[model samples]
Target chain A: MPNSTDTPSNDTPSNDTGSFNPTARSRVKRLHERGKYDEASVFAILDAAFIAHIGYVIDGQPFVTPTAYWRQGQTLYWHGSAASRMLRFQEAGVPACVTVTHLDGLVMARSGFHHSINYRSVMAFGMAKLVADPQEEAAQLDLFVDRLYPGRRATLRPNEPQELKGTTVIAMEIEEASAKTRSGHPKDDEADYALDCWAGVIPIHQVVGRPIADPLLKAGVAFPKGLAGYRDGARFDELLTTNMV
Target chain B: MPNSTDTPSNDTPSNDTGSFNPTARSRVKRLHERGKYDEASVFAILDAAFIAHIGYVIDGQPFVTPTAYWRQGQTLYWHGSAASRMLRFQEAGVPACVTVTHLDGLVMARSGFHHSINYRSVMAFGMAKLVADPQEEAAQLDLFVDRLYPGRRATLRPNEPQELKGTTVIAMEIEEASAKTRSGHPKDDEADYALDCWAGVIPIHQVVGRPIADPLLKAGVAFPKGLAGYRDGARFDELLTTNMV
Candidate 1:
């Protein structure tokens, strides 16, 4: 087995006491060097991705559901039909773990055993409760739309009363959260570096294509200004970072 | 509340006895229509994505960890350091739920309530066990490299005995699996269609950029033929479909 010296120490200093406290549930046990327990790191990963896989238990069985999520400060918000089982269980104050991951690149090493993927991920644990107030729900809905595409909320039709009633919004104050990120090139074995093999990284990017107009759109309707620079081949990372609020 | 008629019946026929039997745990309860139990559908979603969020219950708390996964016939394979807590628990035959999701596009609806995402996902449930046999573990490792990049195993340096010993490979025979997919344009309310708003889709794709060669002493190395066609701006869906093994 390779000695501890072979492993990379990539840990950076924790910001301060103001950063998120590392609870037993939120702590990273494996490869502890990759863990970050700061609000900045956790929120950054959460804000960059719109979808998350929420894990919750019912009847002692674990279920993971992928849904759209948005973060405001330390609170994470998600919604679905009021009758959703996953939402109901979460709203009832059960423990929920929300995870978001972005695959940055494929790390191809000289040996199969050393191959890995570069990724950014966050795991947040908390008890979610229903946003029962209609006014608050409506505001959060607007925020969600605006977060996805800024200023489009003002142009779109407002949510009807019945529409809001049918939807169930849930909010979880991130009680404990941790972010893990891996970047850069593959760290192959020292001796393997001398072997004749192409060892490098293949960058994986999520791109947003051009907006395709609806066939039912009225005549002379132009694309909204909010989506101007988000053209057919815009880099997802650049768009997200530039639009980060 | 959406009545039975308001909800779209997207369910297709479940193949006969040969198809994967959906147990109570694997069934999609919220939107029953979107559930699919056929092997073709489940395998398609599993094969497309290289990463998965594995959910498991530890002391009644759910934890979801995102890791690289590969499927071979009925068995799913994933590896990590032998010291990984998640792998150790899974190797002991604990219940595990592996979920893979691909966000296809953002459904821009006329109203915020109707806004949804087009996605394809698969949730597979099984009991995992460690691959302890050295010979079998070596073969699975090779399969994983080839699965990610075709014919990559032939070009890479062989794994050393120590490397295999340091890694832990786990396999799970999928006992229950289900696939869920949502596609096409937004289904807005009839009255909202008349309103003046650009209602359509913003296609989101995960693309592969040009391979960055490692800055080492290896000069005059040509680009591998296997990775030649995977250009920076290639569409993700087209590439995934064309390269489906």
Candidate 2:
């Protein structure tokens, strides 16, 4: 008999309901078996990543802009100077492709050529729209701050009217999405078992180090207690996502 | 007295002389200050990375393609199956931008808002063209093998006619390029010092583990020396480009 833990869930909600919506998987990858097209899985990957590469067309030329982003439900938001050229995409209703990838570790296979990365990534396709509602935009803006540092939204002065005018919030409702990931150790051939080669994950990690104080900070400002003792290591995204929000 | 090492060369070569051609500082990273653009410095960052996000267009919609790539001189190469949709971009003479970034470490600053990555990235913008010459195509194909594994070009069988026909090789000249880098510890403000926050860099690294043997390999085929003891850490592109052909 197989191990009890190895069985697949028979009654889990299909891709349409619950947290299992895998919408777009075919165009992005050849081996669909390894791709996870579910909405929850896709959102987890996107939220875990701190940076995104947003691609858009400007006057018939293509440009890829790398910036920071945050997600709320099915909507993704990115902020920048209102005068920024990227904001123009939102004004025109142009289709934009936003992508996020987290490189967890490098995978070394028995075959030198099969080396890969242990990563989680999401490619979201959608048409971007400018967030114009004052209350909704303010909530999204606070979410961006909360995403960067948890529980500190009330510590600072609220956004003034001019500050809001100088900032643009562009959002996209994820229409098509796909995620591909590779994890685990090397998959070697049977005959090469006896070969004297070190084979195991070297273990890549992104740890949080001690924080550096800013040069211009006022002398009496104390460090936030929440940021103390942060170490660089892998944490499951589920727990991380909850804590971050 | 100022250090002698900081001075510029007194002599400038004539335009016709080979010496007059200033060393190409990895054309992709021209945005950085000269001191930060050395070949070893730039290559070190490139080798420790994999999977560049490529941006291009189809119709008026922008598309970002994540693909595996290798660099040679001032040119970068990527290929896919002939039938792949990505191949059509090269055939159509459209411009594309490719970016490769190595996330070396995480920046933890006194203020959570200023946190960032210590990264080395190269962005190349140019038109991509497909390789058509049969002999040149064959040479470039061999270059790919030699690139993936240092000593395998002579050992592996040449690409059969069918394989050649099924693959498409596209090369980009890396026209407008820039490499931006942020390294070292966090840059925090002075007032945050007394806050007793620990500020530093969590150095992230990619290391290769032991290789797995292929399951279908013949019982007696020994692992080649070139394939053994390969340390594929975070600096993947740097390793592949510098030592390989």
Candidate 3:
């Protein structure tokens, strides 16, 4: 029997309702077995990552920009300075592909050909539209804060009017998406199994270290409840999923 | 005086001669102060990361695929199955951009507008060419393994002829490249400093955990010396730089 912890929660029906129909553009070509199209798998990978690399084209030239991102349902949002070329181009409803990846481990095998890395990645394709309504933009900004650290919006200073004016938020209603994941131990050649090489996995983890307070922090201010649990050595995935409240 | 460890070794002249002249296509449009054009910065960012998001266009639609990559001087290399769409299009000498990013920390601020992530990223643009020479391709494959684990290629079973034939290696002689880096605490509005919110940085680190040996490993085998320092709690950046023998 497989361990429950080893099985990802992508099969829970509550979060697995809609399936993203992969188009020829969004399909995983190389490894068909690792492809996943379910909403649950896509959402889980998106929610787990705060940064995404967005790819777009301009006059036959392709550019990939790394930026902060947040997801709400099937819609994804990212913001930057109002003058950002990436945001401006994306706001015009251009073809875009946003990808998020998490590195899990290094799979060491007895043979060089079989070495691989365990990772989970999602590629979402959509046309991004500018969020024009001021109220909607403000609400999305709040949600961004809440997504990073839940309840953080209520404690922090609100965005000033000028701040909102200088920022551009673009939303992409995902039209097609797919996720590819690789996990577990290496599969070496049958004959190489008896070789004296050490074969195994070295798990990789993204962890949070001790928080450094700002030099100008108010003397009596205490660490907020939203950040208290984010202690040194805490796992990033655990902090992201468990602190959603 | 600043601590020596805090300064990245980007000023070493032996590796920092040429500057990548920015083409109209590769210029950083916003926040020009963070842009770097020198080879040292670009190579440092590329060497620190094993994975890269490669962007290319097929039929006017852009796609970003994440894959493992290694850098040799000004040339970048990534491999996949012979049938991979990304490698196929890239090998046709189309415009391609390979980007590598390292997320350093989360900047928490008194105002939502100032929240940002400290990161280092490099974007390299070029035309990718297929490595058709079997001997050159095989040598590059060995270099890839040695890049990850120093002296690791000699200890493993060599790549079989069939294995070499099944894989496709793509190389991009970087035409233009630039790096962007942001570090330190958040800079909030002047008046917001008096607010009671906790404002600071929570450093993020990618670390290696305990190694899990293969279930079918021979009983008397010992951990390789190259992997001994990669025990639990080892910092990934330090390991990457220090292990490059």
What DockQ, on C-alphas, does every prediction get?
A: 0.70, 0.23, 0.79
Per-residue alpha-carbon lDDT of model 3 for B56-148, expressed as tens digits? Answer: 988898889898998888999998787777877777788888999998899888988888788889999998889989999999999999888
Regions of candidate 1 where Cα sits further than 4 Å from its true position: A1-17, B1-17, B236-245
- Candidate 3: RMSD over Cα atoms? 4.2
Q: How high is the lDDT of residue B103 in model 1?
A: 87
Fnat across every predicted model, in order: 0.74, 0.27, 0.90
Once fitted onto the true fold, the runs of candidate 2 whose alpha carbons sit more than 4 angstroms away are A1-29, A103-119, A152-165, A182-229, A235-245, B1-48, B104-117, B154-157, B184-245
The candidates, ranked best first by DockQ, are 3, 1, 2
Q: Is candidate 2 or candidate 3 better by lDDT?
A: 3
Interface RMSD per candidate: 1.4, 5.6, 0.9
lDDT of 1 by residue, A93-157 (tens): 88889999988887777778767777889999998889888899889988988888888888877
| Higher-DockQ candidate of 1 and 2 | 1
Candidate 3: residue B1 lDDT (0-100)? 8
lDDT of each: 0.79, 0.59, 0.83
Winning model by DockQ = 3
Candidate number with the higher TM-score (1 or 2): 1
DockQ of 2: 0.23
Error of 2 at B191 (Å): 7.0
